[model samples]
Target: MRPLRILLLLLLAFASMPLAASPAADTLAADSEARWVPFQLTTGNQIRFRALMDGRWVDAMLDTGLSDTAVSASFARAAGMKPLVQAHADAIGGAIPLAWTGLGRVEIGGLVRTGGRIAIITADPRATGPDAVDLFVGGDLLAGHALDIDYAARRFRLLPSGRMPFRGVTMPLRLAGSNNLYLTELAIGVRVQRGVIVDTGDGAMLTLTRSTWRNSGAQAGPVTSAVAYGAGGRVETDLVLLPDLRLGTLPPQTAELRIEGDTGFTARKGAAGRIGGGLLRRHRVLLDPRAGRMILAVNDAAWQPSRSTSGLMTAQDGRRLKVLHVMRGSPAAATGWTAGAEICAVDGAAIPSAYATSAVAGWSVGTPGRVVQLDLCDGNRRSLTLARFY
Candidate 1:
């Protein structure tokens, strides 16, 4: 099926009410400016705006990543927007049951008009926490409009367009386990995946699910080093090299990607992965939450990596890890390591920077027969090892 048709069918299946007859186009043209305002949600999150429901205006987040507009059950009950029926929604996290309700009228940026039956689910119950917003406007609303997100200006723009800009190819996206939009084929071998939660709060290249990598024909290499946080907090993964990655219409190229075995894929299934600042920092990204589209303008001013180097590497979260940070059950985890233990020496030599040189350079996942002696120091004295863990 064509991408647009697929999106429409998905929307109609999820909408709770029958499609309402829209007002005449001329009637709407006159009131456009009076009803719409530039909307904003969390930066780099979703597009949101204020809309009138039952004579009251409320804040709503526009998420094309989702199939339908959902309201929190509590908020719906309070607003008397009860579900007319119940429908099942499949998300990356899991299958969610939701009630359906009709929204009288949806006015966007004072110009467009959309009236439909929307799904009403308990927002608090389905979300990780209560702060997870009250309303979600999904792909149903996006089908009729051209949407744009201006990050620098911090505003969202909507234009009435039958077709979206950047007609890239669409791929099936799966998060957690449910099938969604995986990537959009912009050029040959270049596809941009949606529903990727952007967490500027996090500082790393996009994280890939172990299954995502395994299925993508990418190989997991060695874990030469690891980073540790406080109190049993450590993430151990092998450094993986993706042969090529195509983001949107950008050219295909190889990049250093991390393999996360412990990623909470089952918990957050609605997202395929995350698109971080590392990629966006080099491009002007236009996000249309209402339209379910994004445009990436590569920045020539941004520094491009040389053919030999595969972009700059930064820690996933905030903390950095050393060789000792690799935990048990991991390639580095079984290295008989403990946190807070100091390294005294390596290979029967009392060398300075023993911790830095030995731990970072010596250990990896597939290294074979690489034996090295390590003098470990606690608060007391020292202990030595002859064989190294790969």
Candidate 2:
């Protein structure tokens, strides 16, 4: 599951608009035909599509960052596959015991494949994805096909696999050591060469190593100290509006970026950071992992990416909403909304309860510059009028 999407949505929350369901996996009239599958971008700007896992239709995220298409342990059990404990897998946060199994068949819009690998874990730690989602289609399978993602139109398509001309910057995709995932080197700030993991699964614009954030001396505007949540868990970060971000020889552009505190993640030999949906959403990206190449064409800039309306970044621990970070100049910051404080309620709606959390999250994503009230864990109450930070 994409964590940046969940955290950003928690800060900005999509207006909770209803979306039409993706087409179910019925037999296509023309099996060899190219099909455009419309995906719904959640309030957090995360992508999801209707997919078929073993002939059962389920909602799944289009996650290129993930090396292999994986299913939750529960889903694997439901599919009647015996999960063979393969040992453990380590991530940015820590290590988790992992299991593996095979799927009978997996189906995308018009594409179908049989006997696929699926990773199984005890639980889905990710906070994103629709409740109906059970699968995360990864890059290993996608690299062999012609996949087109049009963020401007908020849609993606699958074309027949072949040698097709592309109009964009092309880069060689190098696999992360001993893994099927691919990454490229990105020159950020000055003198800092960081590895960019092409991950559409992540929602944040960009998150850099804290050392990189400091060593580069990059100037950011209106800093917000907050905790960001994702599949692995929450981490401390200063959400900043980067004055500029450089990607190789590409033209520099001002972008929103996250500066994360180092948490002792076992970094790949020379790697330093990750690139998620935040940056990827700005382009029409095509990946060919097998051939070790990916193409990117700058999409229309008319689309507005998700930003914090309330200027608050929060995390849900158990039944409570912790105020992990607050954006500078936001009403919460001005009112001294400190990090590590629990939020009792938002807009007069109590949190710490499932329904209440949803209510507050929905309220947060509703609309920008709207007035809302807050009740903190310290027994203090304050009113906040929403405003966009980026």
Candidate 3:
């Protein structure tokens, strides 16, 4: 009788405790403590943060697509980092010689990565906006941790490594590659199992190299030729609607993706294609690199419907603005602007590199009756009748 009373009293005591007082709950509560620094989520969720380099604040961009930290040569010199070794980097334009250097210290919102390695690209990367940055914070710096990226709220925070919060879908992240970029199994196609980089900087829905697309056995349907522009200048691609595209067990997403027929750059094992911010913007993403897991709180439904198109993507060349990717059935495509087609002039007047971005939208969208003249590097001149919708 006494033992029964004691058991009853213990049950009562357990029931009277707070809801989240269990051992597992306590561990979760304890692990949730992490330092989260606020960052300005600019266009396309480009992570822009100020970092202390050589006692000076420098603008930095966190690009998950790269494995090693690649800093601008000018930035390296400015930071007083000397050349450590001779190196070469490959871009859309091809391989170029560069110098490898290291910073004394890279302080990110008070978090420090000592002796950060950097590759000095002689000139600015292709995708530099008006506010060009000095650094590319790659996975080398972000490895072995959980990063929670909230696109809608523009929140970017870091969680404890190897510890996952019990919220959102968790997937596997594989780092078996020689590089530091995290890889995961996505349901794109069979032949293309590994080469997908989970990148937030990429604005496209899905981008696959020619080999990846061929391996996937995805039949080429009625398609439009496009030029995909990135840090590497331009890639000629085919833009088509992948009706049977799926990401793991998630509902098959019909995406108008770009297929790079001629990817000038050599991608590593997990580098053929990418799952970009175009798809990731639909949810609150949590990336646990340490555990190789991903948690997604979906804010958008799947297989909804059609959206608008820009049909035009451009990149900056030395002193010229060139057509990097022209969506098939886009305003630029109709004008026969292939990859490497330089925009020597806009409306018959030469435009500088600094004003190149604004020049495209201002002259094309909603004008209805403007002609953007082009002077191609291939020595063929063409004129594009401009209209809205890319």
Model 3 clash pairs? 173-292, 227-324, 227-325, 227-326, 310-390
Q: Write the per-residue lDDT of candidate 3 for residues 1-390, one digit (tens) a residue.
A: 000000000000000112211121101223334545566654443667776665777787766665566677777667676775775655433444567655456655425666535566653344544467787776766665577777666656555676555467666776535466566656665543664667665556677777777778775456766543456444466667777776655666677576665433425332666666667767777777677677777777462212323344555566666654566676666656565566666555565645534543344333455555666555557766655442
lDDT of each: 0.41, 0.60, 0.56
- In Å, residue 97's CA in model 2 sits off its true spot by 2.8
Candidate 2 residue 158 Cα shift, in angstroms, is 4.3
Q: TM-score rank, highest first?
A: 2, 3, 1
> What is the alpha-carbon lDDT for the whole of candidate 1?
0.41
Which prediction has more favorable TM-score, 1 or 3?
3
Clashes in each model (backbone N, CA, C under 3 Å)? 22, 5, 5
Candidate 1 per-residue C-alpha lDDT over 172-250 given as tens digits, one digit per residue, 9 for 90 to 100: 2222112322222221123344445432212233455555555555443443332311101234444444445666446
Worst ten-residue run, lDDT, model 3? 4-13
Model 2 CA deviation exceeding 4 Å by range: 1-33, 123-126, 129-132, 158-162, 191-194, 215-217, 248-250, 262-270, 302-310, 315-324, 327-334, 338-372, 375-380, 384-390
TM-score of 3: 0.70
lDDT of 2 by residue, 70-169 (tens): 6766667787878754745444444445576655677787677665455665433543633544777776566566667877777776655543445787
Name the Cα RMSD for model 2.
8.2
